[model samples]
Target: MDEIATDNRQGILTRIRWKAGYMNPALRRIADRVLKAPDEIKAISIKDLALQCEVSESTVTRFVREIEVQSFQHFKILIAEELSQGSSSTPPITDRHVYEDITDQDDTASVLSKVAARYAMTVADTRAGLPAEALEKAVLAIEEADVLGFFAMGASLLCVENALLRFMRVGKRCLFFRDLGIRKFSISTLGPKSLAVGVSNSGRSISTVDSLRQAKAQGTTTLAITSFPDSPIVRHADICLFTPTVTGVIGPAEYHESMVSKIAQLQVIDVLYSLYAVRNFGRAIEGLERTSDVTALTRY
Candidate 1:
């Protein structure tokens, strides 16, 4: 989150001007009106705003998302907040410690504190960003699939492995491949009854996207768990679940080196596993207990 200038009358104008050049023609028109006449625009409906901008209602929706406001109502709330803050400057609400890299000078206390806070924010933002309807649909798809194939690359691969460990216990057929060539072969074997999950935060991983593409081609339902909704992976996915792009307060890289995206991805897995187990608790408990009992003999 960014700070607002409390006393500035033209804060909205400044924000629009800052992002205007980056926006296309349609979004620019929307931004211009909000910047030039914040009070009037705040009172208008989205339909009226679309007519004023000479764009479709959908374009207005896209503009709101482009501006990173959750909705048109949310954008108006921000404008109202700006108006209410007329002349008093407030302290920035965030810290500069986000996505910080570790250094030789750091001690155990600093490392622990930074790591804890980062996980806290990462989990919170991920929870907020996950679309509930999409999540339910993904869980249902997995439950109905004859086999579930997970596709991931590099560090992202670990997130899917975490899912594999949990999903396997539910007595469902799950599959993956560490080798890219082998992975594609496995994807080719899936059909309409299969579900392919492409796990990529950026959604541009060639191997992961390619796997989803092939899976879709075979009539398998594809689910994308990513931070980017507009990424190539989304095009191939039948359903898309977004995660928060939590790099840092200062706009760092795609994700933190400590694997905040991994945390986000794992959280989705946790939710899915929980939902699936609850839906089939009797079978889930039996499977878990049977596995536990079998493994316990070897453990002793």
Candidate 2:
């Protein structure tokens, strides 16, 4: 295998940690092994690494490719280079180990530090991991859509609410409903000129997936902001925007999305809103001024 140029790459380990959250069980084991022991990985052969991670040799190849490395040799070379440098491309979060979960043995200060680190890392990694092409398509869809419909449930709904508020200020017609029946009805009313965005970290939420499904059936452009690239939501989405799976900072086996996931999703929302506003600068500013004026009246 041809060696990948280490100089051309930035933060190989950071990329692995970011993408690890969305990986399948087998691939995740490989990633966990690599992140935990880069020095060991650099010295281990592919066959040995595969055996150690309890995955097949092919799964090891897939993990390397998923992180955009060309081959296992190239992956090890990069790890070796990173190790020789004596530091990671991404700065360390406090003095604590990366991806260390908050434990009950910690005090209030430790919790604060860990939570802050998680938030910072989630934002940085998410920004790095998002696909530019998909983001561009999502922005264009929003710019051209006659109406925008957001579908999410649970903590994911908080992200939707923030998007609704921000987009509304920029004069976008947005729809969101907490009630499933009402949300489904609202989504059903949207047709070809509308955009449907479903937010789900797991990508398996029944309501969110069904809402995207309903939108696609109506020929509305569908966009998904999810951690899992192959999740059910992606099957219905015309465009998919990914956020780093912040699961690294929390329990590894925790299936439910955490508060850190919301932070990551919120950052995606802010990016989308900013890009849309930039594309519609004049109208966006005017709408913002108008809305600000109206909202100011209610304040004091």
Candidate 3:
């Protein structure tokens, strides 16, 4: 009806071209159900649609609102209009695609391609969805903190370690805790001037959450880089950066998702680091020069 709402509806259809990867969970579920049975949903009642999706009527209502529809009636009208115009946009692949791609690949190249594509998608999704204010908060935290502590469990530890090294090279006091006991002990000592960054793909790692909680309780600035926004860890964080997980059948092969999520986390950290270097370029250069002089005699 209104110009802004009209624009959102058109935008939603266009976003479908990028797949529904950026849609919130509730809206995504509704989109998936509707796309699967476009013809049937065009005439179905909202109550029946909720029953079919196993979600509440309010969820359906919220989904319609997300697409800028005034109500279910308008939503159905738009759906019918699209259908009549022969709209046949395909919904994005679900968890099944992740499993299917891995199980069906016969060559190393093909497997690697799929894995690379997933990571690329994660990066694109992360960049597309990242909010400007969150980026600014993270940058400011890195800039003003007296110390930076990184906590990550499982393979995510590797990404945190790399980030710690990068910051250290720029003369920032950075530490990565891979041991759960040591991490908790360290967190207890953080103060208002310190920053604690936790990385978890699912955002549900118990140890990581505990570490953040401890840090926050001590007045430390806590930030979380996670795939799930609803994760408990985010509640305690001063800043929350999200990454989209590539869902697949649960198993060892889920490592693919882990890797993609890590890339997204690292991209965020990279931006923070770049901003820090720019803000303190002169000081960083001086530190690099001093380090070079001390190590000059040891070089071959």
**Candidate whose lDDT is highest:** 2
Question: Model 1 — which ten-residue stretch has the worst lDDT?
Answer: 1-10
What lDDT score belongs to each candidate, Candidate 1 first?
0.74, 0.80, 0.70
Location of the lowest summed lDDT over 10 successive residues in candidate 2: 1-10
Which candidate number would show the highest TM-score if scored against the true structure?
2
* Comparison by lDDT, 1 against 3, better one: 1
Stretches > 4 Å off in candidate 2: 1-71, 74-100, 249-254
Name the lDDT value of residue 268 in candidate 3.
79
Give the distance in Å from residue 139's predicted Cα in candidate 2 to where it truly belongs: 0.4
Alpha carbon lDDT at 189, candidate 1: 88
TM-score of 2: 0.72
How are the candidates ranked when ordered by TM-score, highest leading? 2, 1, 3
Model 1's alpha-carbon lDDT is 0.74
Which regions of candidate 1 are displaced past 4 Å?
A: 1-109, 248-258, 297-300
Per-residue C-alpha lDDT of model 1 across residues 1-300, encoded as one tens digit per residue: 342222122234334443443467888888777755677875899999999899999999998776556677877877777655642333244523344444554689988986887678667656654657777898899889999999999778888988888888778789998988898789888999999999997788899999999899889999988765446898899987766643421222244333767888899889999999998899888878878876688775
